[model samples]
Target: MGSSNTSFRQGFILVGFSDFPHWSSFFSVLISVFYSLTLFGNSAIIILSQLDARLQTPMYFFLCYLSFLDLCYTTNIVPQLLINLQGHDRTISYGGCVAQLFLFLALGSTESVLLVVMAFDRYVAVCRPLHYTTIMHPLLCLSLAIASWVGGFNNPLFQTSLMMVMPLCGYQLNHFFCEMPILLKFTCEDTGGTEAKMFVARVVILVFPVTLILGSYTNVAQAMLKTKSMAGCKKALGTCGSHFVVVSNFYGAAIYTYLQPQGSYSESKGKFVSLFYTIITPMLNPLIYTLRNKDVKRAVWKVLGRGTDSG
Candidate 1:
């Protein structure tokens, strides 16, 4: 059957942080700061990677994509969230809600898969150092990057379309924004089967990529152990550590958000987790890489100094 021809004309009120009236101003300011940092940091990574020829390598290639994804990912949600945080009106149009849901799901899924691809990049760089350049050549890197995006955007398209068509009891969403599980509450029918299907899909989207990330890291660890140079081991750890931090922050929140059986989740707790996942994680990513990565720092300097190559 086709999607419903009738428009969901009514806009949904985002009852965001309403339960904690006291923290409204606090979160508004905090989220605004986080959003700014996220934009600046991710953009810096992308621009620096592009401008500096020195950063034109497989690892930084993935990092550039990651930064771009984070930039788009946060932009999809934060503006609306900031509006809701400050304004008297806390409503989102039906069209806007669906767009957010689709884009967020797609971007988040893409980031999950991209992280796995990055892990593979690290694996090849560390475990198979001699063959790294030959293996992760331009064509293969472009292919992997394209695959991550295509897979990311395509998987959520059908599901989000079907979800948007469901008949709703009302337009007042229980929580902020348009997450699937939370929006399931407003559904007029029994969502048990649908919920089950969604859970299964979520598992496939999250688990598969996460499993690959873990596997790649495991091999990386073993390979590092076999190597005698402390410098090689140190470099390997430095490369993977930032990604590991990002993965734990992102996946921990996402798993709890999606996988935990419906209704068991505390809305307030979920709000906090969602904030961390959506805002804090993106903000921390560049900071983590900058502090832990000498190459990135030197590249930043090289770009600023106009060709003082560190190497």
Candidate 2:
């Protein structure tokens, strides 16, 4: 929410707390534990990728970026939430609210863009194996990462700035953290244009990435069919399956949350989908990636052995 009224002393302040479920204690504990696990899991991914030279490859490079993004994205909301669940008011100052909105958008958008880049990396490695190294050269990878960050930075500027122009008065957000939709709902003004801009942002961040991932997998499938070898098919299928799983978990919940029509907003339903994307997906990424990937498994063992000997 934004304040257009220059004279208004204070902007939107959250007036009421959410009505927790009867089983809120159980759910709160679960949420707090999941939040801790997400931080630990993603932190390990970042650390392991950076520490182990053997894990330093184009794939794991992108993964480390993803893990870092997830960590930042999850941190934006979850820590505040734990504070709220402990019966604290969890009031964010106006400046702090804007910062939260920007960081959340930047990291979330970066992650979406990075996933597309990752798909292209996989496509090159599989479909055009001869050129994989040259195509995804270190410089190219660096440039792509920079572009993702730049795009992420710019995309949210429009949305957040627009909100800043509007005057936030008595409207309080319904959701735990500040999301674009929830913030817009609390603006207490007509959001006709804001809604459109947000929809466009969602398409830019999400739809294009999904298209790229799907296209990459389609090409991989075609290449595998041409190979006519069981081993070749298996390898191709394995790569595709891993990518699909990650993409589905990340994108599915995100699209459901963002792409809904403006007035059709269901607060409870929105909360559930937001939980899936914000909480569930980060927890799943490293577990799914490492458990299914042999190279990462070996690296994990190597690290464990070193730790054991050191201890």
Candidate 3:
């Protein structure tokens, strides 16, 4: 145990793309560009959702929270990643790794639940338009948002606590960040029971939310089919389609990463998949919403027009 403590205190080397040292510079630049876009895009969504009166509905309210989550999510991972990619010093302190793991899991789990919540909002809007306002009152929205966040952070507390006590065999983390499955690879003892428990937790966080999102979308699709007017059908599809795309991208990569058996986990493939969720997805979210969403586009032009006139 003392040796384990000393090993942790000494910190672990992040073997991030070291095998492809020549490509590190390229990835560094690409990630930097994506990080900047993620910051700009998600920030714009949050600001527009607040500043535009048209966007003050339940959908945008949830969008604002989603943007905030994406911002924190990318910020937690991208900077450390860029640093590791840019320099030869590929080490992270023990505390930093723990913080990364905790935040990563919490933000991810929260987003999973939040996506389901957004789907529920869409279902209410599409299926029960008459009672949408009554059903999705501001208080209810707030309560759901708060619950998502609280549940997200709570998930990591137990998982991280379990990982911290396990005796590790080495100091080389084979990936870019401190992920649970990758971290498990270093455990020296029999981790079957622990892995099973963590697997159940992952399923709760990943699978359950996906199942809920799918159910909500199924209802939403039925409602869309019943709408006789072409315009109404188009609008409903546009709204739900954007969300479905986001959900597909996020949950697809996350499920692939988390659901696999530990023995079959491919470190090389995992790195790229991690890149997609952590960096690419956040950048794409605002684009997906804005391009497909007329209200958000109008809000953007309104804000820009005001800026132009003031200038």
Candidate 4:
């Protein structure tokens, strides 16, 4: 908030994918479809988790957390992207850009943490079923969720402040969105030290959660293979498969984008990678969960069928 307003007051033009002028219409249409689907899918999950008592368990609780985070995550970026893609006005005010950057990082960082939490939830359900109730109490779940939010909100604070204070040559962003890495490109100083700091932050916010998720899932896998019931083994494999798919979908794009030093960042690569995690992932998540899980499908039916039955 304390950053200088001199360069920002004029606002920055988000160049987006303007390089491909011919594809604007196609991009617009594709993005609109994804945006619409992301909103509807995540919203349905959140509502269904609350409406169906069967979903009152810890898994659904964390599913709702993921749904909510993806909702906020895409809502913060996709609308702006759609507008920039479809309309001539690609300019976001300095304040708007900063806010977008901040919110996106917060939601994204929290979602990364939440994924680990969800993995832990699965581990408990599968590996420690006996004490799952006592371990994942409502209060503890609430605490974990809050900690995720807090960690996310704080991750970008110091770095953003530092980035803001650094001098930038121009207000034109080569990409469609405002992101820390891209913004770092414009800063006037030699970004060697800054890039180091960013890499460290990325490790903390992104890598740490990913490691946790992997560890939790590994435990789940080990425990799952020992189960003698064929039916139970099949079910466990399905659940773990779905979770791994989601995990790979998210972490793959994010790690590729962030883990590298800023010096190695490719504008085109960053643009497409950003497109994946921000637009594509949210749209795909609900489909993955619902198609893969019988429980989610039943919850959807129960929630949507109520009004129809009454009518």
Query: Which of the numbered candidates is closest to the native, going by highest TM-score?
Result: 3
- Comparing 3 with 4 on lDDT, the higher-scoring candidate is 3
* Residue 301 lDDT in candidate 2: 72
Superposition error at 121 for model 4 (Å): 0.1
Question: Where does model 2 exceed 4 Å of error?
Answer: 1-17, 306-311
Per-model CA lDDT versus the true structure:
0.82, 0.77, 0.89, 0.84
TM-score of each: 0.93, 0.90, 0.95, 0.93
| Worst lDDT 10-window in candidate 4 | 302-311
Give lDDT for model 3: 0.89
Question: How many residue pairs clash in each candidate at the backbone level?
Answer: 0, 6, 0, 0
C-alpha root-mean-square deviation, candidate 4: 3.3
The residue pairs that clash in candidate 3, if any, are none
Which candidate gets the maximum lDDT versus the true structure? 3
Q: On residues 1-311, what C-alpha lDDT tens digit does candidate 1 reach at each position?
A: 12222226676888888877888899889989999999999999888888878778888888889889888888888888888878677888888888899998999989988888888988888888899889999999999999999988877886686687677667676667787777776777676877777777788788888898899888988998998999988888887888888888888889989889887977767777887878889999889877867667777777778536646
Error of model 4, residue 150, in angstroms? 0.9
Model 2 per-residue lDDT tens digits across residues 48-118: 88767777888888888888888888888787776766666646667777888888887888888888888
Candidate 3 off by > 4 Å: 1-6, 306-311
- Model 3, 104-190: lDDT tens per residue? 999999999899999999989888989999999999999999999998888888889989888876788889999988988888879
- Candidate 2 is scored at a TM of 0.90
Using alpha carbons, what is the TM-score of model 3? 0.95
lDDT of 4 by residue, 1-311 (tens): 23334456677989899999899999999999998999899998888888777778888888888998898899899888888988668999888888898888888888888888888887887888799999999999999989888888888886677777777767788899989889888777677887788778889988888888888888887887888888877877776677778899988888898887777999988999999999999999988888867777776666766433222
